[model samples]
Target: MWQKLYEELQDQNFMIIAVAMDSRGIEAVRGPITKAKTTYTSLIDCDHVVSDLYNMVNVPQAVWINEEGRIVRPTEVSGAALSLNLKKMRKTREIYCNAIRDWVTNGEDSPHVYSDSEARAHLPSYTPDIALAHANFHLGQYLWNAGNRTEGESFMRKATDLNPNSWNFFRQMKNLGNRLGSGGPEYMARVRKRSKLGNEYYPLPDMAGMENLKK
Candidate 1:
């Protein structure tokens, strides 16, 4: 995806930089990443400081920061238009190259375009409960990945209790159960209950591999 966008913008004199939020360091990504011939700049923000600054709670979130250090669009997205390409890329695709090309060639005319208001409206609703849940979840994941399994599970359970509708949170719980069996049926039950609340937005674990969890 980065490579495609880099190519597109290279000819257009536009600069693009990808700040990776992956906890893994740049050395891990450099080998496969360097395989692409891209002209744009890219960096990794393992601590998520930049993501927090931009209020990007998820990956694939984009911000069109203008030259004046002002954010023109904070949530201009691209994945919506790449479904078919992504499907094809599943076999033989150079994602970054194609995407970069499209963006650079089309500039703002690309498939993903949004105004400031539109971007702001796309943000998560600012409910106190939800905000607190988000905080807990973030801390939980940080702790979980940092090897503080007990503390992570504690915080994650709190997060799930606050926002039972978050499939992602429950997914983490499910993973924890697999690892430590700390929170088993009870936590899994919360996942199912809340997953139902998410309806179409929620994706339950595949029954084939994870059916036992639901049982």
Candidate 2:
């Protein structure tokens, strides 16, 4: 979906820089990128520096930055325009794609583009606990790189305990061969819980003035 947009808008001074937050390195993401045939600027964040800077706790999140280095939109769950195997996400994909098109064509005039204060309002507050969580996560990554799996896992667990809302931290640990029980605070377990609560993992964008696009 992004590649299609990149093709369409590249001539219009629009570009997409995809950052993959995979700790296992480029080899882990090479297969998927190859399958997608993405041509835009693609980067690997082994230390999750981008994730930390953007305050992203989930995969497939996006932050729209304008040409002036301003954040037009803060981090939010981003989906492809093309439908995946998940039929339930088709409507969401359509809405998301339309919003992107509107933004691209209208620029700052687009209703989807938030003002600086509005964008900042959506960003998460960096509390001391969250800071500690990030520190622990990076420390864990360092230890894991040093071939000390035991200590790494310990720090990873502490990071998770400190910031349970961060799926990125949990995902990194899980990818590193940490197996949690089905009832544990793993990805699937959280999904199931959120489903029961009628909560959407990717909340729909506010489409107040753009109601006609729904048709």
- Taking all chains together, each candidate's TM-score versus the true structure is 0.54, 0.84
Q: Write the per-residue lDDT of candidate 1 for residues 1-215, one digit (tens) a residue.
A: 66654554566667777776544356746866687655578787644556445544334556665445655455423332223345432422333235445544675675433466765665545456666776786787688778997898788789767765454455545554474332577655654564476532322211122222221
Q: What residue pairs are clashing in model 2?
A: none
- Please give the CA lDDT of all the candidate structures: 0.53, 0.77
Residue 112, model 1, lDDT? 34
Quality of model 1 by C-alpha lDDT: 0.53
Candidate 2 per-residue lDDT over residues 131-210, each given as its tens digit: 88988998997788789999998998898888777778887887776434322556777766755777455554554432
Mark the regions of model 2 whose C-alpha exceeds 4 Å error after superposition: 80-85, 178-185, 193-200, 207-215
Which of the numbered candidates is closest to the native, going by highest lDDT? 2
Give each model's clash number. 15, 0
TM-score of 2: 0.84
